[model samples]
Target: MKHSSAKEVEVRVKRTFLARKKPTNSLIDGQVKISIRFHQLKVRFKQLSVELNLFNNQSSDDRHIRCQRIGTRLHIFILIGSSIILALYSSLTQEIHHETILNPSETQYTTLAQVLGDCVVCPCSTFSVSHETFISIKPIYHHICSGDFVSSAWINFLLRSQFIDFVLYSDYHQQQQQQQQQQQQQQQQQQQQPQQQQQRQQQQQQKPPPPQQQRQQQPQQQRQQKPRQQQQQRRRQQQRQQKPPPQQQQPQQHQQQKQHQQQQVTTTTTTAQSVASAFWSFDNNALELYNSGLDATLSGSPIYTTSFAGYGAAISFTRSSTQYVYITPKVLPFNSRSFTIEAWIYPVSLSSSNDYGIFGQCQATSSNLCLYFIARNNKLLCGFYNNDIQGGTIITMSTWHHVACIYDLTTMTQQVWLDGSLDGSHSASAYNGLWGNTAIGATFQLGSASTFNGYIDNVRFEARAKNSTEILNDATLHVYYSFDGGSLTDNGPNGINATAYGSLSTTTGRVNQALQFSSGPYISYSYTPFYFLGISGSSFTIALWAKPTGSYAQQTILLVEQPSSWCVHYLVMTSTGQLVANCWIGSNIATNGPILSLNTWTHIAYTYSTTNGIRLYINGNQYSTTGSFTFSGSGVPMRFVLGGDRVVRQYM
Candidate 1:
C-alpha cells in the first residue's frame, strides 16, 4: 500500500469514498458528519496555513486581507443573532418588572424583534439592551414603538398617572407649609395676649380713686381731727393762764396801754359818724351869722332856709322895674371854730357894680369875717370884711363858683378854696362866739330888684369841718364814691331837671329807673349826648340814663371806637337793656353776659380788658363774666357817644 506518496494518498481517498457509498443510509449519515468535519478541518487548516505563512513571510498583505474579510463576516452574523435573543429576553424582563405582562397568556411567545428595533437606535455590534432600557426608550422608542406593538392608550395612561402624582405631591407640600405658618402666627398671638392683659392690670392698679368717694371721706376726717386741735389749743391757753405776770412791767407800759385805750375810744367816736345823715341842717345861730339882727334891709322879706329833703333855698327879690337895693345883717361872735360854706348859684344878668352881695360875718354888721365869693365883674374875692366895709377881695359873678371858705382854728388862718383848689387866704382876728346866722335880701337883687332873677341850691354849711388831710385819710371815701355833687349829680341847683338810673328817686324813694330810653322831638339848639368821665385803663364801663318811649327798631346806646383801629369797643342796648362789650385785640374775641330789660332806666356797666376779659354788672351787682383776654390795640378813644348824636338824630 505504500508504493509512492502521491499514488498511495489518491488510492486511500478513493477507497474511503467507495466504502461510504456502499452502505446507503449509513453512508449519508457518515457523509454529513464528514462534511461538517471537512468544514471545521478546512477552517482550522486555513488558520494554520495563515499562521505558517505569517511566520515565513511577515509582510504579506494579501494573506492579511483574506483573513480580515472572513472574521468580519462571522462577527456580523453573530451580532445579528445575539441582538435578537437579547432583545427578546429584555422585553420579557421589562414586562415582568412593570407587571404589564405577568402571568402571560397567548401573547407570551410574541416576537420581541420589533420592540427591540424600535427601542434601539443601531442594531450593529455596538448596540446593547439593559434594564434601564425603558427610560432610555421613552423619548425615542415610545413614539416609535407606539405605532408598532405598544398601544397609544398604554403610553397615555402612564404619562397621565405620572402628571397626577406630581400635582398631588405639590398640593400636599403647599398645604403643609400654610399650616405651619398658621401655627406660628397662633403661637405669637398667644404670647402677646398675656402681656396685654398684664399691662391692663397695671393700668387699673395705678388708677386713682373716684373724686366722690374722696370728698365723702374728707369731712369725716376733718370732723374727727378738729377735737384734737381744740384740746391742744385749750392746753396752751391753760398754760398761758397759769404763768405769772412779769414784774419788770414799767409805768411807761401802763401809760402806753392807757393811750391805746383812749385812741380806741376816739376811733369808735369817729367811726360812729361814718354814715352821717345827708339832710343835716345848717346851724343858723352860729357866731358868724349872715342875717343875725331883725333890723336888716331884708326884714320885710321872709327868711330863706332849706327843707329837710331839698338841697337849697330859692330866695326871690322883687324888682320895681329893675332896681337895686342894699341890705345888711347883724354879725355874731367867732372863736376858734372851723367853718366852711358852699353854695351853687346862677345869676340872670351880671351887669351891676362889683361889690359885695352875699357875705359871711363874724362881728355885728360884719366886723371880722372872711368874704369868699364872686363879684359882679367876674372876679373871685377871698379876704376879711371889717366894720361893715367890704375890704377882702372881689371875684366876678357871671359864672358859678364852687366856693369853699375854710377857717383853721389851730392855725388861726382863714383860707378859701374854689373848685377843689386853694384860691386865697388871710389872717383873721380872734373872736369868741362860735355860732352864726345867715340872711337873704334885696342886697343880692335878682333882675335889678328885690325879685332875685337868679337860682341857688345845694347850700352847705359845716361847723368844725374836717380839714383836707383828715378827709383824704378816710377809707370809706377811697372804696366808695362820695355822694357829693363833685362826682355825680343827684339834683341840679334850684330844682333843675335831672335824673339818675337805678337810684332811690326823690319822689318815690324806691328802687326805680332800672331800664330807660329817651327819644324826643327836634330842638334847635341843645346838648344831645350826655357826659361820662373818670374812666381809665383798658376796661370798658358804660352807665347812662335812658328813657324809651316805645320799642324802637334800631337803637344804639353806646358805641366806642377803638383808638387808631377799626374794631368796636362796646355795643349797648337802647331798645332793650342788654350790654355787650367786644374787644378785638389781634385775633381774639371776648363776650359778656346779657343785661336786657325794656321801658325803664338801668345802670348797666361792662368791664373789659386784656387780662380780666369781660364782666357785666346790672344795678350794682356783677352778673356775668368771661375769662381773661389779650388786647390787640392800645384802647378805645376817650371821646365817645352816649344816647344819640345830634347830627345823626336831629332830635332831643
Candidate 2:
C-alpha cells in the first residue's frame, strides 16, 4: 500500500480546513472513532516524514533517526525502539485547557465558538476583583499537523482578532467600580472607628472600673496562681535557652498584628476628629490649584501626564523611601489670603526628633514664605512659618487623616481642620497682608518634607476660604488661548485682539502655525480695561511655548512694562540663551530664572504667587533657583507687549 507524499498531505489539510470547516461530522463523531483516527494519523505522519527524508537521498538508518528527532520537534513524543516506534499523541485532556479571556456577551461568546474551529474555547474561572468570567482558547497547534500552512493561517487570524487589542471593556469597568466601592467602604470604616472608641470610652466612664478592688483582687489571684504561672514562665525560658534556640515566630506575627491594629485605631481617630472643618462642608466657586479627586478638576489650566494616576491605585502614590511627588508651580495657587490647603494622609511614624512634613511649598530664601505641615510635639501642626500659626492638634502615627489648614488674611488667623472638624486655630501676625504678600519660589511638594513614610491624596489647594462643599464646586476658567486660529484672536470669551507690529515675521508654530520672528517681528496687544489681567495681583501664572530658531537673547517674549516704572521681561531667552524672568521694578531687579537651551521648543511658565515667589518652570519641571531677590510689584497698570520693549523696531 502506497502512502501519500508531503505535498498531497498538505493539500488534504488545506482542503479539509478551508472547505469542510462548517460541515458537520467532518471530524470523526464518537470518542472511540476519533481515537482510532488519531492513531491512523500518527502512523501516516511517520510514513510521510520517512518518505520525505528518503526522497531527499538520506540513508535508511539516518532517515529513521532523523524522523525520531523530527517527531520530537513536532511536539509529538515518540520513543523509537528496535522493533517498533511508540508514538505518543497528546490526549484531549492534556491538549485542551478550560480557560478564557473574558466572559464576553452571549453573542460574542457564540461567535468565538464558531470561529475557533477544532480549537476548543471554554469558560474556566473569574477574577475576585471584577468577578469577570474568563474563557480559554487553546493554541491551534494541538489540532493541526506540524508545519501545516492551514494552522499558520488560523494562528494569524486568532492573533489579530482574539488578542491584539485585548481589551475586556466590561471587565475593566467592573474592576474600577469594584475598587471605588472598596475605597468608599474603607473610608466609612475609618470614620466609624472614632465613634466606636468614643462609645468604649463612655462605657469605661460609666463603670469607672474599680481600680483598687481590681488591684487587690489581681494580687490575691496572682498569689493563688503564682506557682502555676511561675512554672509556665520557667518552661518558656528553658525552651528559649535550649541549644540552637528557635526564635518564636508567633511573637513577630503578633507584633505585626498589634501594629496593624494600632494603625487602624489611629486612622479612625483622625477621621472622627475631622467631622466639622470648613472644607468638605459647603459647595461654591473657588480657584482649586491642584486636586487628586476624580470628581474635582484643577481651576485654571489642564495638566498633562502620561501617568495620570500612577501614584497609588489611582492618583495617590503609596509612600515609600525614594518616592516623592513634586507638583509643577504652574498648577499651584501658592500665596493667597483666605486660602485653604487640604490633603488626605497616612503616616507611618511620628516619634522622630525631626519634624515630618506632609505638604509644603516653602521658600528657604529670606522671604520666609511657606505653607506646610510638620509633625511637632507628636501632633500635626499646620504652619505658614516656623510654627507661626500652629493649631496644636494631636496627630498619631500610622493613621489616615483628612487634614486642612486655612488662613484668613483679613482675620489674621490660621485654622487647622482635621478629619472634618476644627482641630485648633491660632491668630498670628504672619497671617496679615504682609505674610500673604511674601513670594514663595519653593517647590510644591507632597511627601517631600523629610523621609515622609505616608500616603497623601486629594491634595486640593483652594485660593479662597472654601468649605468642603464649596471645594467640591469646580472653578471657572476666565481666559484660555490655544493660538490655534490663523488670526491673533483670543480663544477665550473676552476678545483680546493682537496685531502684528513692524517686520511681521510668521513661522510654523510649535503646535501649528506660530507668530515667527526671523527679522524680529513683534506683537502688540489691544489694551483691555484695568483688572482685565488683574490690575495688581501677584497670584498670576504666565505660560507660553517658544521655539527659538535664532537667538531670543536680549529680545523679549512678553514685557509687562509701565515704561520706565516696571519694564518686566515676562518671558525672555537671555543673551546667554538662559531664560530670564524678571521684573525691573524701578531698577530694583527681581529676576529668578534658569538657563534654557536654544532651538528646542520648550514650554516655559513663570508664576508669581505671593506665598510661592517667582517660580520658573521649563517643560513641566521646576529648574534650579537662579538665587533670590525681593520683588515689589508696582500697583501701576502695565501694558503687555511681545517681542522687543516697544511694539516696533525694538527687537534684535
Candidate 2's displacement at residue 306, Å, is: 43
Residue-pair clashes, model 1: 43
What TM-score would each prediction reach against the true structure?
Answer: 0.27, 0.26
Superposition-based RMSD of candidate 2 using all C-alpha atoms, in angstroms: 32.3
Tens-place lDDT digits, model 2, residues 1-652: 1355877888989998856644456453465467779999999998875544322334468756677556554543332341243233323236545544433564676576688855643412111222234322223233233345566676676543331211112434545666887999999999999999999999988884478888878878888898999899999898878834236776677679968965644432211010111221112221222233212322222122111111111122222333344432122333434667766555655564655665555432112245666555666676655445555567766545566777776676777776666777777544211111111111222322343455454455555666645333222122344445336665532234566676554456667655555445666655422221323333556777776655445667777765664456666666776667775434544454655556666777776654555677778888644344445556544456766421211211
lDDT of each: 0.42, 0.50
- Which sections of candidate 1 miss by over 4 Å? 1-313, 316-334, 349-353, 365-377, 386-398, 427-437, 441-453, 466-652
- Candidate 1 global CA lDDT score: 0.42
Q: After TM-score superposition, what is the CA distance of residue 424 in candidate 2 from its true location, in Å?
A: 21
Q: Report the C-alpha lDDT of model 1 over 359-406, residue by residue, as the tens digit.
A: 333222233432323343444443344411122334334333344555
What is the Å distance of residue 557 in model 2 from its true position? 1.9
Number of the top TM-score candidate: 1
- Separately for all candidates shown, the number of backbone clashes (residues 3 or more apart, or on different chains) is 43, 36
